[model samples]
Target: MNILSQVTRIKNAIAEVLTGKDELVELTMIAIVNKGHLLLEDVPGTGKTVLAKSLARLIEGDFKRIQFTPDILPADITGIQFFHPKHQEFEMRPGPVMTNILLADEINRATPRAQSSLLEVMEERQVTIDGETLKLPSPFLVIATQNPIESHGTFPLPEAQLDRFFMKLPSGYPDFHQEKEMLHMYRTKNPQDTLKPVFSLEDILVMQQEVQETRVSDEVENYLLSVVQATRSHEFIENGISPRGTLAFMRAAQGAAYIQGRAFVKPDDVQFVAPYVLAHRLVLTMEGTMRKTKEQVLKEILESINVPVESEAGR
Candidate 1:
């Protein structure tokens, strides 16, 4: 609960600029606490870039931004080795990925090779250049933004890379009142300017450890697995949730429980986080897509599974 207060401060601070999206904010925080990266898939001018930057500013850590483009090279993000004339040696230079918070803007616009540069660092938190590997800073998080409406000069992210993201969220347009408030605030000054850091990188690292410590009862754990397994046997799904995704779902459930001041995860915790955690990882059959979206398919999976009783859930 003490951690809840700190995280609440962070959420409220970010809400100043990202109006009317509290659930999205909560989900984003969950991703952070679980040490998972995010992919923001939405149309332009939906505050995707602003959200990424605000999150970076909210934590006391190094922040870096990379604008993904067609010409971007692998070395541009993961770092490069350059020859030093005076030293007569090749010096390894760290790129934007070396920072604590990285905002990968319009990531889909980059070539696949350039985008693939992030795989190692995202999964292993280390970058290799010229046969030398360097560990990235602790609490490293990548909040990547992509415009779903644009296709020209953009390369689609492969399924392997997509699975790396813990969640793919949409930054939808704000409601009327929220938009009005945003306009009023923008007339005077950017709301993000007044934002301040509420927690430190060290705090985040500690909180991440706490999230993993959150308990999952045997029945609740089985329920979670049942949902994942259903995805695999579903008639419409070509590929179901991967083992990595199964682990991600458990981690996300733990984060959800921690946020709600609970020491143990419940079936509700898994239900709340399952859709976001599983949607993108699925490879649907063409018939499935024609009948329903990935979200809809996931919804069916959740509905079909029997949730554990309260007694079984240790509630």
Candidate 2:
């Protein structure tokens, strides 16, 4: 099947259990193709777990969930080396992170030590235990989530740690119709239980390469830079987009254009993917935080910049 056809199949498979989350599903696929991780913020019972679990099933990847808590230890997640008395030697055991899809449910509930343990694994795709390093399986992606409504007993992720995530999603509440449809669908069965992989890991790797090759013209490049520059100079902003963020911003637009069956990145592609890729990396001033949200400030920044014409972006 072609790339668009494969994307359709994957999205449709997720729709079996989720409703009105097409954008969420689409962005998740983009993240996979671009080799990025997602951090979802929402209250419980809004399909956060279900979405991640369903994607793991649809991709046929090994899925593991770690319900982080205050008492959880770093060794519990990065694995531990224990002496085997029977064999009179030490044994190496891998943790849940060894899987392809890891659901870090309520990630903020864990202590800093436990939370920091994932930083290296997330960035390097490898974990170290007792002076030994173990490379993670292919297509490793972390879909971490935290409850937004509750602050008690939660340690919020710092700016440094937050920057490690490629994109952050609010995972908004479902609309009335979407919620109704979801209720009716789940009344019968958990559709994910019957799900199977629609595409292989190799297929995804190939798609990643194709997406990386998508062209970004000079006009579009300047337009994207203008937006990033605005974030740094905005009156309400304390900190702006970083060099790492700029790279992710460009790559996400490439994936967006590729998904639309285009060989070249357009201003629209950058605009569409900008909020997801840039909002999380922003740091608002104390006054800005009280006056507006990161998304609002990002929206303003986007509005201030002029989008390059198609002829200018690419022909």
Candidate 3:
């Protein structure tokens, strides 16, 4: 099957369990193709966990969930070394991070020290324990969720850590019709329980390889830089997109194009993914934060910049 067909299959599978979230499903697929982690921030009972679990089930990958808590230790995530009298040697015990799909539920509830442990694994795709490093399975992806409405006993993720996520998304509450549909769908069985894998790990890897090969023309490249540079100079911004953020934006644009069944990146692809890619990376001034959110600032920046015409962007 073609990439678009495969992607559609996976999307439909997840949508069966996660009702009223077509865009969320698409964004999750974009992150998967880009080999990037996602941060789902929303209020409780927004189906964040169900969404992550549904994706895991649809991908046929090994999934693990870590309920992050303030008392959780770094070793609890990266694994540990224990002495085994039977083996007469220290044995390595890998943690949840070793799996292909890791659901870090309530990530912000963990202390910074414990949270930082994920930084290395997320970037390196490997974990070290007892002076030894173990590589994670191919197609590793972290779907971390946090409750934005709660502040009690929660440790906010540092800016540096926030930048690491490719996209920060919200699993908003379902509408009345959708919520009614969900109630009926789950009246007897959990939708997620019946979900079977639609694609294999190798299939995802192939799609990712194709996404990396997706084309970006020079005019589009210049347009991307112009937008990022504008963020740095924007009157209400304190910090702008970094060089790393620029690369991520490019990759995400390519992923968006791939999802649309296009071999080349278009201005619309960049525009569609820009807010999600750039919002979390930005730091607004105190006045700016009080007046507008990062998404609003990013939207203004996007509007201020000129989008390359199709002829130019396709050049």
The segments of candidate 2 whose C-alpha lies over 4 angstroms from its true place after superposition are none
lDDT of 3 by residue, 159-211 (tens): 89999999999889889998898889889987777888888888889887888
Tens digit per residue, CA lDDT, model 1, 240-282: 9999999999999999999877899989889999888999999
Q: After superposition, how far is residue 282 of candidate 2 from its true place, in Å?
A: 0.9
TM-scores for the candidates: 0.96, 0.98, 0.97
lDDT of 2 by residue, 1-315 (tens): 377777788788877888888889888888898989999998898888998888887877889999999999988898999899999999999999999889999999999889999877899899989899999988889999999889999999998889889888878888999889888988978787888888787777788788998999999999999999999999999999999999999999988888777889999889999999999899999999999999999999999899888788875
Candidate 3 stretches greater than 4 Å from native = none
Off by over 4 Å in 1: 86-88
lDDT of each: 0.88, 0.89, 0.89
Clashes per candidate (backbone, < 3 Å): 0, 0, 0
